[model samples]
Target: MPPRRCTASAAAGQTGSDSDLDEFIMRCLSCEEQYDMDDAGTCRECYQEANEAEEELRLEIDDLKSKVSFLTLSSPTLNPSTADIVLVPVDDSDAAPIPAHKHVLSCRSPVFNAMLENDMEERRSGTIKISDVSHDTLCAFVNYLYTAEASLDNQMACNLLVLGEKYQVKHLKTYCEKYLIAKMNWNKAIANYAFAYQYNCKQLRSASLAVILDKMDLFTQNEYYAELVDTNPRLVVEIYETYIGKQLNTAGTL
Candidate 1:
């Protein structure tokens, strides 16, 4: 009889524990003010907090999704034709590359200023001789060293190559070469060749020579031929003979 009573007591305790758990789940899930299995399960306060947390998490997810989409999208200029070139639109009135920005020569570092001054001194003495690099190009170089912002115009590309060769600035040289290769008109290639040769830029010289050789007939026909011969006589003759002479000989019409 005593054993039977003990089992009955344990069963009663288990029933009470399950009833309490059901009440708690209902209160949290259903947003009820109060819940009881006795009163059909309700607790409003816990439910309201759960709803608020869900809305907060939903907004956070949306924000993260927007960021993900932005990161995945590519720039419009990533097209193959425009990949190597950065075009800056200019008005006829603005003769300079662009308006001066604070980052150009406005560094507060004395070490950087001294370096620029030294560069200027080297340039004046012709000790740091480089073909076609102007004061503006020097300014750009200083800006790049200090701020890591390099702006090379279409016309300045050739100059940058010479500057790179003179100072052994490989990064700047590569930047100019890539841009020149991308936008190489026949005339620009000829001009670049003259500067590159003067500076003993072997890679650029070979590239320029190849461009001229490939378009020898066109160069001979261009008004710039005389100027090119004056600047790089050796290259002019070599490219002319390589392409034009070969064409004439092959045709048996020389």
Candidate 2:
């Protein structure tokens, strides 16, 4: 047989068509056998094994997500054994900053029992002196004690805020103040105004005043002066005098 001719064109990378991949696979110097480029690029056996490993990892990830969701919804008291716990590492910076708690203490809370007994006794006597807050309020309070996370919703916070103030839970009171201050819209302001005023929440009152003042023109123009007068006549008078009357006074002075 004649020696096969090898040309510069072949060396300069002209891929022949049995599928370009096949030509490359056949050109491999290691194994003298020609094979499809797709086959040459990957060992089918190894590719299948890698695919199986990826699928297993995906399933493990999905299982972990499901477990996390289950743990989140399961109440600690109801399913104590099924709780998922995670340990977080404290860095040097985190270790260095020791938070100064104004009033953090470990003590048994008798407020719950006392309120319950008082409510029950009132109910039996037919007086019903205590309207009685709900179990959810108590649960939220207890949870706050353990986790210190103020996850109480607005209505729950309103219920608990009264309790916190009554029980002298200064921490809870402060927490309510901070959250309510951030959420000091007109409705909540009106709802909690008496409580805010009674509890001496000066900041809450001030926040409410600021909102009223900012929208004074709108209130006056829209004839909703009732909301203002209802909250504080003195405050309403102040707004009218400062914003409305003052402008009138300024015009007169001019």
Candidate 3:
């Protein structure tokens, strides 16, 4: 094939003019879209380098995922007979105890490690009673300790996050925080902000506060807003303080 030319005719329906023909057009190697000089993105060399970097990152992610799969234990629910210890939700007597491995629980949570490793009643009875948690939440918590996975809805995420913080399971706490942050919006913002404050989840608290600041007028009208003020007046005051600080920063910037 003859060497490709940057002719004006190359652009559909455009007649060639000396200036237009002289202007170069190239296909973007990244997006694979054609572009004229003015619309160009990266140089060919940079595009090629970017492609290499992306491939390397993809490979690294795949490697990390594979390692996670290899390290993750099978859910104790699948084979309760093999579990050495059981977790009972104190509030739900009728609920069956959740089966789990002591080693897995110990490895995941320092609280569990101390409870089981030391001369504790939990170790002797082979049963650990978890208070202020539902049977389903206990089951999910134990499953996550083993498999590092959970089927989370908003409520479940909140439940698990509370348990995660109580147990000092940092990874699970971070996971639940990210989920809540991603699901944050105007409707849930106040409630989530209150929950984050109660739980000491700074990241989720900041994100929820940002949402609340954006819709301050509507926030007071939210059903949860009054309940939060009644339940935790201190937290409500903090929200106002944050909003005021943000306004001050904006005024300074302007």
Q: Name the top lDDT candidate.
A: 3
Per-model clash counts, in order, read 7, 1, 0
Q: After superposing candidate 3, which stretches have Cα over 4 Å from the reference?
A: 1-22
lDDT of 3: 0.88
Judge candidate 2 against the unseen true structure and give its global Cα lDDT, from 0 to 1. 0.53
lDDT of 1 by residue, 85-199 (tens): 1212222222222222222222433432344466565324322222344556654654444344466777677665665665566666777777776776677677767766676
Per-candidate TM-score against the hidden true structure: 0.42, 0.41, 0.89
Best by TM-score: 3
Tens-digit lDDT string for candidate 3 (109-158): 99999999999999999999999999989989988888888999999999
The TM-score, computed over Cα atoms with residue i paired to residue i, of candidate 3 is 0.89
lDDT of 2 by residue, 1-254 (tens): 22123455554575555543332334333344555446455444665687889999999999988876554332234443432221111222222111111111123234433433455542243221223545455556545644555576777767667767766676777788778878877545444544577676777767766666666546554344566577667755655566676568879999
The global C-alpha lDDT for each of the candidates, from Candidate 1 onward, is 0.55, 0.53, 0.88
Query: Clashing residue pairs in candidate 3, if any?
Result: none
Q: Between prediction 1 and prediction 2, which has the larger lDDT?
A: 1
The superposed Cα distance between candidate 2 and the true structure at residue 109, in angstroms, equals 6.8
Cα RMSD to native, each candidate?
A: 21.8, 19.2, 3.9
